[model samples]
Target: MRIAAGLIAVVAVAVVSSSVPPEPRRAAAQETAVTAGATVETEPVAHSGDAADDPAIWFDPTDAARSLVIGADKKGALETYDLTGKRIQRIPDVYPNNVDVRGNVVVAADDDTDEGVLRIYLVDPTTRQLTSAATVPTRVTAHGLCLYRSPKTDKLYAFPNSVSGRVEQWELTVRGTVVTAKSVRLFTLGRAVEGCVADDASGALYIGEEKVGIWRYGAEPDAGRSRTMVDGARPEREGHLQADVEGLAIAGDRLYASSQGSSDYTVYGRMDNKYLGRFRVVNSGGVDGCQDTDGIEASSRPLGTAFPAGVFICQDGYNLRGTTVERQNFKLIPLDRVVLPIGTLPIPYP
Candidate 1:
């Protein structure tokens, strides 16, 4: 009788343990926390909109400390903020989805009105303000924009992608102080495409297909539709990108891409598009951690003491302070700080 009772108790305990879900037990045992470098968050944007989308850093030609960080408030205007995070200027009545800087020109993909075009603005280096230049109609609705200057031919071009997956390259010309654009070539990446950056030195283009992954293509207009999948969002695979890779930016020879689905950023080799590693902007020095970033911009050229070895800017999906949820803003992380963990430093520009 004593042996029977002992056996029944053991069987009962085993049955109860088996009844508990295996998934929860497995998850508790297998899940591990990911570590990434921390970043510094700048002051929030003036207009508290959920539309603080993309950022472009325009360095001052004469004064490095007086550089301006231009942000696209996709809902209303293009705003310019000083390096100290003060809103200096705002261009109203324009809805810019993405913005990029090439030389003295600030090209943004506009969706404010019926005219789907690129709004060109000339940057006043002295005042660090953007002056209205001209608008070049792109026919296709512009969603994401990037400025590319060809190293082979020294031609200035703009690549804009539409929500319908149409990507076109436009050759931009400057006549006196005015800017205009002419279509050079067109291509597509099937589904929704956005977040593109060009490496003029290597003549390569990196674009993110929101649902798919990251792709590398030739910047030349006639480079044909040949493209290589640099990384895919496969959770099962090691070092694979999570879904919705939204932003692409190049810092020196490396590329930084936002993996929105994972709430982290992935790095890759700019020339070979090889997988490097992944990082997340964590809370540090009184700033909240970043989540679900959309657009990002990086510069290899150092900008004053704030960014001695260049800076990497990411659009914050959630901007919160204390209990109050503030407007979405951009966070600036020193490039050296970001690459320090991976043992990669900024290579000198040739």
Candidate 2:
């Protein structure tokens, strides 16, 4: 009886995952996605409009003081917070919705305004404070921000997913606090894409589309010049992961993504959109009552030698009941604490 039940469950996931349109519209005809947390309970840092939208974590075991994770509250403010869950200070004048960090620097793409710009922050992770680096002109609505290191050239990349239907990857260079951007590479998806993440170890990038589902890009310096390596990913269905999928993370070999409408998360270990499992956000004095799911990130949640690393953090979409205008807030939940895994991945993000 249990065997039949198990088969039925597998059949359900397969049907939902394989439910793409038929034809030139077929997902098998589209490029595939082979890509890519846990955290605690915290009283998220509040924003003036939406409570929490996006989060980026920078881990430095050598310098724990300098290790930090930054999140966007998406009202008119940006926030700096430590690993143990402490508030740093509110960055005044930022309209950023997504946050991604590397080393001591963090980059956020500000949406809600028409300026089309990327805001760079010079961060002192120890103090949890930041100052403006420079504002670079982004051609469209900046939605997702990530740091990528090119494997072929070993050059650093700061890629931003914008509303203009193009993903921009820029080589990064910094002298003290000033950043000089170079070798800008813009790769066009068939349409607008959001929620992008990069795996520096393998030199690959994964892009998630709001209107569509998810797509993969090889991103070699020469390859990014053209649109060839995208794989067999389907356009998102209307009621599933379709509700504003805005975050991506990798653990071992699985890629985890959040669907805002259902207030739930979906996991796919391999390149394909096979739903391994699903988990929802449970509200407590937390912000989810106001917002749906938004940004997400992952790290090793250390328990003991027996278990692999396990923490995950999620960003809230709205605040104060989603009725009044307020900022977004960050919520920390451990992966092991949230869901049971079918298999343990060798490395995060295949």
Candidate 3:
């Protein structure tokens, strides 16, 4: 999660509570060595420091080659880029921390006001432009956000979580150019939390409690607080996850989470919630590797000749250009390059 420059020190202290234990040190050799490389990298965000945050892929159904990547510039805007990594649009003055897109609707967790808000936008398929639709206010301080379109109910929902661990599920409705929302459920995960993704096919919502591990909950409006631990951060448990579990993404039957403290990503089975493996994005082919990553998005849908088997987008916290430090940006890697020790099984897209 990106914090304002002035509040960085304050947030650092607030994130680690007394109940949480300090992270244990793990040797670099102990972590997975499998690596993937990026083929395309987006332009840096307008702000100088700690700006670029999360990304959501908008797959153009009619023409996958025309798909776009929408990202949140925590400093104050939302930027969109085409598959070739060219910046297409920038909606400024909105301090959004996380972003998600489903169908024609794009939602961002905005903290520009005293009360957190969800900035809703409608995407023009042909033009690939985002038009402001509505801003629904929430009680919590929005930090992480994701969208879900239930296959069972055919209704759209947004899950936005705050740094305080409060999560709110809102049901969204769109009519023509206008959008509306109603708060359906609210609950806290008991620690600072951020990353979240919903499995529309299984109706499961997974939340990452920064210091703890991943937890699963039902995505239905009436699902309530009941949850099951999918994995843990406790060193003794020997789990792949490290501290500060950041962004989460689901592609095919696989679930990916950014293990920030370790500079790697851990994968799991979307259907069974079983640990799959871990991999890192390393420097190769002129593009720098991803380190201290914050958000990531993956799609199994082929996008042109560049990414025949789809793509994986990551927010590179430490963007570099031939050893020269540059302003933060996002990186694009072909999904097929992400090879796991136990090869990924084919699962029909949801």
TM-score of each: 0.86, 0.73, 0.90
Task: Evaluate model 2: give its lDDT.
Answer: 0.58
For candidate 2, write residues 129-209 as lDDT tens digits.
Answer: 688888777756677777776656766677777766677776778889788776466777757666777776565677776
lDDT value for model 1:
0.74
What overall lDDT, based on C-alpha atoms, would model 3 receive against the true structure? 0.82
Score each candidate by Cα lDDT. 0.74, 0.58, 0.82
In candidate 3, what are the lDDT values of residues 1-350, reduced to their tens digit? 22223311111122333322122234222643466788999988988677889999988899989999999999989999999889999999999899999888999998778878999999999999999999999978888998888878899999989989999999999999979899999999878998899988899999999888889999999887889988776443446777778899888778888887776788888888888677777666777777778899988788899998878889987776654557889999988777354445366342
How many backbone overlaps does candidate 1 show? Answer: 0
Which residue ranges in model 2 land beyond 4 Å of their true spot?
1-39, 63-66, 112-115, 225-240, 270-274, 283-291, 301-308, 318-327, 338-345, 348-350
TM-score of 3: 0.90
Root-mean-square deviation per candidate? 10.2, 8.5, 7.5
Clash number by candidate, in order: 0, 35, 0
Candidates 1 and 2, the one with greater TM-score: 1
Q: Give the alpha carbon lDDT tens digit for every residue of 208-316 in model 1.
A: 8877777788898878889988777545333356666688888777888887766667777767677666666656666665666889888878788878887878888
